[model samples]
Target: MTSLDLALIQDAYAKLRPVVHQTPLFSNRLLSQLTDCDLYLKAENLQITGSFKIRGALNKVSAVAQTNASGVVTGSSGNHGQAVAWAARFMHLTAQIVVPTTAPAAKVEAALSYGAQVEYCGTTSHERLERAQQIAKDTGMTFVPPYDDPLVMAGQGTIGLEILEQRPDVQTVLIPIGGGGLISGIATAIKSLRPDIRVIGVEPLGAPKAYQSRQAHARITLPSTDTIADGLKSLALGTQTYPIIERLVDDLVTVDDDEIRYAMGLLLTRQKLLTEPSGAATTAYALRRPAQIRGQKVVALISGGNIDVPTLCHQLNP
Candidate 1:
């Protein structure tokens, strides 16, 4: 329905095979009992780049590979920084990644280790993008947008493609939304495949652009947000992704930091899964409002595993 199609995603899967790991899926019996749903966890946190962002990063970079340019540039909250840096390295290209001032030191270090030049910008993700774009234009770099690119969304769609095929009767697919790349791509593929399936997007209550956009039935902007889930703190929804979501996504939900922390603790204690706050948004929603999504064959994406190790260790055994 958008610029990207299944063929493009298929090609991306082929290109990504060498670089990205096919993350595993596992049955969550405790989650099932708690939420009264046949819940499956798509362990994207265990993905090769430690998040689903690598899929979009590789697809976007490969789309520009034929241009044979000097380098590419992008801005991110954290996960996308690592993804772009990893992709740039794999493709043998230079990457200039811009991050907001609040981005975690651990994430920035990972990007640097991947050999990308990292820059710190304003306090918000939108401001970082503005800086990144200007640098790309001034330096003749290919501007690799985090979520506003068709290629990026298509790559993220592959997650939905695999989920539907793996769990044929999946009734709901819940994904966390920051800039909307992952949810848009996933909603596009899954809704196209099975119109009856529900596509739910989770956002942090403090960072509610996606929820606002859905409410307005048009693109809505966010001023700023302060949330512990730094990865979900985008000031606006993605441009290219908004259309896909307007057409495909069935519903949206939100969770607060306390809920996220509770979900993270539950996963650590009950499931032994180490998830960042953003990745645990779906579980938070499920736990907070079980009756709404209960008793469904649901697929929830644990979108990243790049937690602060010491922070997680303290939470786990505290």
Candidate 2:
């Protein structure tokens, strides 16, 4: 199995410096008061391609461009698909993205806008991945695994390096979990650099793969997932991501859709930032468990802001 380490993440940071944005780590006074902690938001929602997935996508695609493969194919709910499409375009390669039929129209359009051919598959990560792999096989294109590949994870880890540099006194970090890519990468970087700092992961209560997997002491694959955080509805943890998370993550927690919606509303109303449900998950946990993390310096990573207008209105009002 592939592994992630600090050195690999450092290399990714060096490689990405010319391309990726070092997004802000800014604090909101109201949020800090509410959570009773010095809370900062790692604003990857403002990153290029509108999410941190671009970091991994660009890093992976740049490496693949050195190969003889004609192009690249991958599956995503939305954010990663957009990143892959954008990266492929930047690298001057043809790209194909397989997304679930239920993926948001805005996200699909965003991917298409990057000039990648988009195909709709069944409404599940597994189905989309299978179809993407088939396409790659038939076309002799490289298959970009969203969260499982070491290059991708290392690329994502660059965020951790930025976080530590931005806030050396950070006591805890709350990251939203999907297939464990984001959390696994960040946890590896943080723990490798500052072993004393806590790295916590938050998941949607409806899709608690990482939380459940930790309890079961083995990877757990859900037959189905239902979550308002569509970007976080990964049915299983990545094989490569799970082991790193298991070893380095301090704790795994969960918040329901309602909490996520509340967090999104708060982010918009109070922080003046629009965050998707997946991005608001960690903030939701922090709000819900203020007593647990109070009196500490905490950073909540806002993973993305690619929400459609209707969903955004509903989340803000509901």
Candidate 3:
């Protein structure tokens, strides 16, 4: 289990300050009453790129600018692609983003909107990584992995900083896990600063790579994931992230698509928050498995809000 120093996370916050939003941390009394505890929402769904990925994307691309790299190549389900594309545009560099065929149309279009050259590949994390790595090698561009680098993880840790700053009494944090970068960074930052805090991870049951890996005490790759939470469908956690999760993270849980959808509806109607399935996953875990989080000051991290119109309509209507 590797640990990042507070200094590193603080540096990430400082670097990201000018570019990123110090997103609000809201406490919903309704959520607190339902869970029998004080509940806070880290509304990262309202982030600049509509997700927290921009923190890492900007951090990595800014570091890339110091070198003589030709451009940047990376892979994402959607939000990270847009974040990287926006970061590249911010630095006046070319960005080629390889996305899976399963990636949402809105996300691919969002990347294109940010001036990235979008390439459709196989619907798997491995496939996108291979393509992005090859592009970086052949084009002399820097390969910014979606969730497997120190700089990226450090950048993502900035959210943990904001959380503590906003609510120093935070007892537990429920963060959605995809490739584990977000959880890895959050756990690292929180544990380093306040080891008493509990860091729990939420993943869709359709894609329980992180949960399975933690149980097996080693990294495990899934054959496929059939979750609607596209942002939480990575086949496996990163090598860099797995150990940190195993070490620093308190627990990992999974929620089904129905649970996610129900939570999404609650977020929309009850909480008055717009969130995609992936963003709603943390709330789903707390709502579905309430016993674990009862009586604790919990923060549910809404990771993104880039829901497509059809899915949004379905979730809203259903």
Candidate 4:
């Protein structure tokens, strides 16, 4: 698969350091022991606004600095919306975020806090995207898709730049799957530099597009979706992300909702990292498939930490 050029990603890292946090790359001895590999955690959960969504969101918003974005429009139920809204505010631009009614109020409030005008719609994320597209077209606003753009992918690729430097011996990387932004970005950059470093993306079986898409040899927009991994509830991989995954991603593993909850519990008890279900996907994958990771130095990209409190309380029953 064609991967991103490392120099380009490095340049993006240079551009982003001021706004983006260089979240820690800490070794998780317990996780490593579970996976039978040398495992490190990419604490992207500690990033600004608690998610890596900012990297791509900022890159896209900043790219439009010349246009001055009359208004920016995008569809998201969570992190992406907040990221876009935050980036828009940073650029002194107006942002119009479309979300489904099912999205958490905390996320919507966070977006509004950053000065984005919020619109809510139907039950499903797909319905929200449809509304967002119409809003962009009707208003002459730029529609920023969460994972469909090359520029955004390149921006997200900054994670790969960090990975290579922090752990050169990393033989494997497990990243959470959403619209496929995080994995696509990291795979594009890391595989280019260290072709031997296998990139295994983890998706919740509750939201299984990445795994299904890989098996089909094409992007499969699932007819319907359900999962506690709110960040990964997208129905399909973006066109931009699909091609990259087919080329660069080494494998895609899926874990069910219960497994995800178990992983989250493990993270809290074992690593002292408070992660949302989606963020724990890679770790769950590693635990389940330890044989695949045995003897290798691995990293699980803990993508974000923004779990809704009530949701966590219910899921964990603590």
lDDT of 2 at 298: 97
The TM-score between candidate 2 and the true structure equals: 0.98
| Candidate 4 residue-wise lDDT, 27-79, digit = tens | 87777777787888998888887788899888888877668658788999778
Candidate models: Cα lDDT each: 0.84, 0.92, 0.90, 0.84
RMSD per prediction, one decimal?
A: 1.9, 1.0, 1.7, 2.1
Residue-by-residue lDDT tens digits, candidate 2, 36-106: 89999999999998899999999899999999668999999999999999999999999999999899888
**Tens digits of lDDT, candidate 1, 1-318:** 448666767777677777677777778678788767888888898886678999999888876777898888998888898998898888889999999887777788899999999989988877889999999989998988888877898888889878977889888888999989889888877777788999899999999998999889988888778777888888888778888888888888889888888888887778777888888998888876456577788888999978787766654455
Q: What is the TM-score of each candidate against the true structure?
A: 0.95, 0.98, 0.97, 0.95
- Winner on TM-score between 2 and 4 is 2
lDDT of 1: 0.84
**Candidate 3 lDDT, 147-253, residue by residue in tens:** 88888888999999999999999999999999999998889899998999999999999999998998899999999889889999999999888988999999998
Candidate whose TM-score is highest:
2
Q: Look at candidate 1 and tell me the lDDT of residue 31.
A: 74
Backbone-clash count (model 3)? 0
